[model samples]
Target: MAQPALGPAEAEGPCSTPLESPVHPVDEKPAPSRLVPAALQHIAAMYAGVVTPPLIIGQAVGLDQAGLTRLIAASLLIAGCATLLQTLGIGGFAGNRLPFVNAASSAGIAPMLAIAETSAPGHQLPVIYGAVLVAGAFCLAIGPFFGRLLRFFPPLVTGVVITLIGVTLMPVPVSWAQGGDKEAADFGAMKYLALAAFTLTVILIVQRFGRGFVRQVALLIGLLAGTLAAVPFGLADFSAIRSAPESLDDQDDGEGEGGQGE
Candidate 1:
């Protein structure tokens, strides 16, 4: 068979030997950068976050200054320990070193709030802890079964659950927009609305165009942005521990003891 010769124009165009398909680069995983800055960032991010829920719940329960102060401290300490356990996993007991930072899960928030509201006529921390212990046991007993049944969840069921979760969480954004507490005198105030709007805008912008690391951290960025924006309006309180009288502390202790006796 006779081979056809290429046209002069085609022959001159970049040596035309099929161009070796341009040798596209393989998507190799990038080497991890130094851990010092990342670890510091993780710790700082987690430390500030793990204390807020207890503080809010304490306030909701009408705890006097001292009682709420202790609650906040305890929450921070426990959260720190939980985070350490997660990041530096225990052999068969606790940890799972997966960039995991443990904090209070939002799933428990509503139930805990209910307990805080209905807690027997006095200090509710003990009751809350007791209930948490029970709930944790319940989860531990069921979690493995759920894990084993992972294959049972097909795409349809996963989609339904995800849709339901989104629907359920819509109220959280609404509540935050309305200042986070239903009973607050300024609940639903303009300041809170503005903060929520700013956060939503930032997230939307990120989702629309952000790439790589910026896209990955968009939620964290939005949260921080919302928090910073709220600070000037008295929404993000980072005041150092304020002193409370010993009498108030003793009073709570007495109430707690009395409630336990009853």
Candidate 2:
């Protein structure tokens, strides 16, 4: 094959050599009308994400309803604080200064559950929290060098890991279907199972029949419908909500407890 000669313009162009910065130029400001709608969507996305990890881990660890509530409240507080810092860090001393939702993640659930099972009954939560703290510190320590490590994790490896995460998590929804109060004698009773089925049906119905915002929030709608449906079956528990802490300080006073979700 003949070697192609570079033209005069090609030789002089900026593309002749590699560019360094990867950041693309973007509009600094968005339409004012979009702000509220964008914020609402963010809240919607964060709703399920912020709740699931704490709910699952707390329940799996045998926390009572009060304890579970506290764990979830704490997770929400931490996620909110982290998100704010991530979006508005001063002088790049912390955070990425982006509108990123920093919330509890589901990735570490398996490991945390393993830790809970291995630890003595009463000591489960403390040991698991210690492991989490150490892991977070390790991640911070390696943050600057993490880019180079990505070379070892190509698309195929990442895809497999994601699929495994999904597979490993399948039991969680099943557990939810049974009943939140696993210790109750009537747990997984026909009524509870029927409620779960109805909730799923509602989700599917909305996805298939609704449009726009209704479809977008099908899961949430189904959840609300389920809660309402459960009232007649004596599955609803309103005392938890009534007794819930009024403020962060209240939740703090009750905290002896803690999920990874999104």
Runs of candidate 1 exceeding 4 Å displacement: 1-33, 44-52, 64-69, 87-89, 97-99, 141-146, 153-176, 179-187, 207-220, 223-262
Cα displacement (Å) at residue 136, model 1:
1.9
Clashing pairs in 2: 104-261, 105-260, 105-261, 106-260, 106-261
Q: Model 2, 1-262: lDDT tens per residue?
A: 9989988757676544446334343424556787678777777767777898888789778898777877999999999999998888868467887778886888888888889889999888999999999999999889979999999999999999988987887888877788755678877888878999999999999989988767777888899999999898788889877887787676665563421221
Score candidate 1 by lDDT: 0.71
Query: Which residues of candidate 2, in runs, are more than 4 Å off?
Result: 1-27, 181-184, 204-216, 243-262
Q: What tens digits encode model 1's per-residue C-alpha lDDT throughout 16-109? A: 4556234323322234674565665665556545665765567667786667767877877787787788767889766666566676654565
RMSD of each: 10.8, 8.0
- The collision pairs in model 1 are 89-95
Residue 112 alpha-carbon offset, candidate 2, angstroms? 1.0
Q: Rate the local accuracy (lDDT) of all candidates.
A: 0.71, 0.82
**Each model's TM-score, in the order given?**
0.58, 0.74
